[model samples]
Target: MAELSGRFRELQDVTSSPTSGVPLSLTQREPEPHANNPPLYDGDPNSCRAFLSQCLLVFALQPRRYATERLKVAYVITLLTGKGREWGSAVWDAGASFCTDFEEFRAEMTKLFDRSVKGDEAASKLARLRQGGRSVTEYAILFKTLAASCDWNEGALRAMFREGLNFDIQDESRLRLRLRRLAPHSSWRLEETLPSKSHPPPQSPLAEPEPMQLGRIRLSAQEKQQRLVQGLCLYCGGSGHFALSCPLKAKAH
Candidate 1:
């Protein structure tokens, strides 16, 4: 019992020693300090308020430019959200920027949707409104909303219809009918013309002098005999006698 206690004490002492077993130096190496400063993660309401205020200021100071840019930015954000790093980077490289306010951005997005839902039927409605001298911007805004709210293809057809309807009424009807026919196969927008399926016909070569072969054939013996033949010639397969004695009836007869 005495010897066993001594062995146990020796084992405990070895484990507790700084210089023994598993090399204390290996475990005691000092940790390297971080290169960056500690992150300042302020969970306070004040910090959030300040950040939001700055964004609002930026938005308000340049609403028009920001509005235009924000439209594109919002589209990018929606595309990138929930995607992996590779997809996010792809979108970023593809010219997508971040928008500070999604709500304002969405309001603009609604305009596009509204236009699409109207499909190709909005042209006459828009024309009537236009002839009545309604505010063009208001009319445009209504169209925009319609465009933003619907499927991309549908919106495009609606826009094309509106554009076609803007021309002369008679021409507009033909254009509208064409658009209606085209709507199923394509999503053509009002802001642009539809692409043609085939190129224009090539121009013909310049005129040339008649060929010698054709000219000679025109004055050949056969040709002269054909000219001499009268009505119902037999040799030339008509009902007259021979080409030499073909008769001519008097005009009075």
Candidate 2:
């Protein structure tokens, strides 16, 4: 009996933490994630819609065990500005009742924003997406983001992207980009499919010669050499048939 009691005491001591005098299960637990600060967002239709997306992303990215939809919406409202600033106040009424679902609050904000929000506007923006000064990758991102709200299939989206591409990109490049996206089975890349400019075009046999003046004749290399040696200057020393017409001479005044 005495030995059993001593062994049980030793087991208890081994399982407990010596520094804090607490069991591992009770002591080793992490808190739910909560943002100390959220990104500032105005109530504009364009920027606010993007802000809502970011707010949702923050919750997804953070490590949390018991975070609620209500908490997420509350955090999002805290960062609102302009007309958005008043929304935080109006969220709670006299009885302190407020929206509990994140989706409901997001929808409410969408309706509340003054300008045209993400619907037809989003589709229109995607249709008109152009590279302009932006890179192909950048244009792809903008188009894809706007396209999320639209119902375009892969082929139609590819066609739209090609139509809005910068004029500097050759038709071949636009075709390559479109083909790669349209054909799911084949493997192709923009970087790998670029045209090589290293080789010069072959000279055409039927190409026209440049027009020359009637009185002046273009000289052959052999004819010019023969004429160059024939000229001897008693005055100024120079070369070529130009030397024959030299008006320059040494004059003692």
Give me the candidate number with maximum lDDT: 2
lDDT of 2 at 51: 79
- The true-versus-predicted C-alpha distance at residue 148 of model 2, in Å, is 1.9
- Residue 123 in candidate 2 has what lDDT? 58
lDDT of 2 by residue, 1-253 (tens): 2333354345344433244765545424644356444568767766766677777777776534215655555566667776786665467332134457767777878777735435666655665566799866677667666766765444444445544565455555565666456434523233332333352222323333312212444433333223323442212334431321233421110
lDDT, candidate 2, at 53: 72
Tens-digit per-residue lDDT, 77-184, candidate 1? 323222222342453445433333455543433332222324334333332233134333344456444444333344333323243223222444454454445333
Badly placed stretches (over 4 Å) of model 2 are 1-38, 62-66, 93-96, 114-120, 170-253
Q: Tell me how far candidate 2 lies from the true structure as C-alpha RMSD in angstroms.
A: 25.3
Report lDDT (Cα) of residue 251, candidate 2. Answer: 19
> Residue 147 error for model 1, in Å?
1.6
Count: clashes, candidate 2: 0
lDDT of 1: 0.35
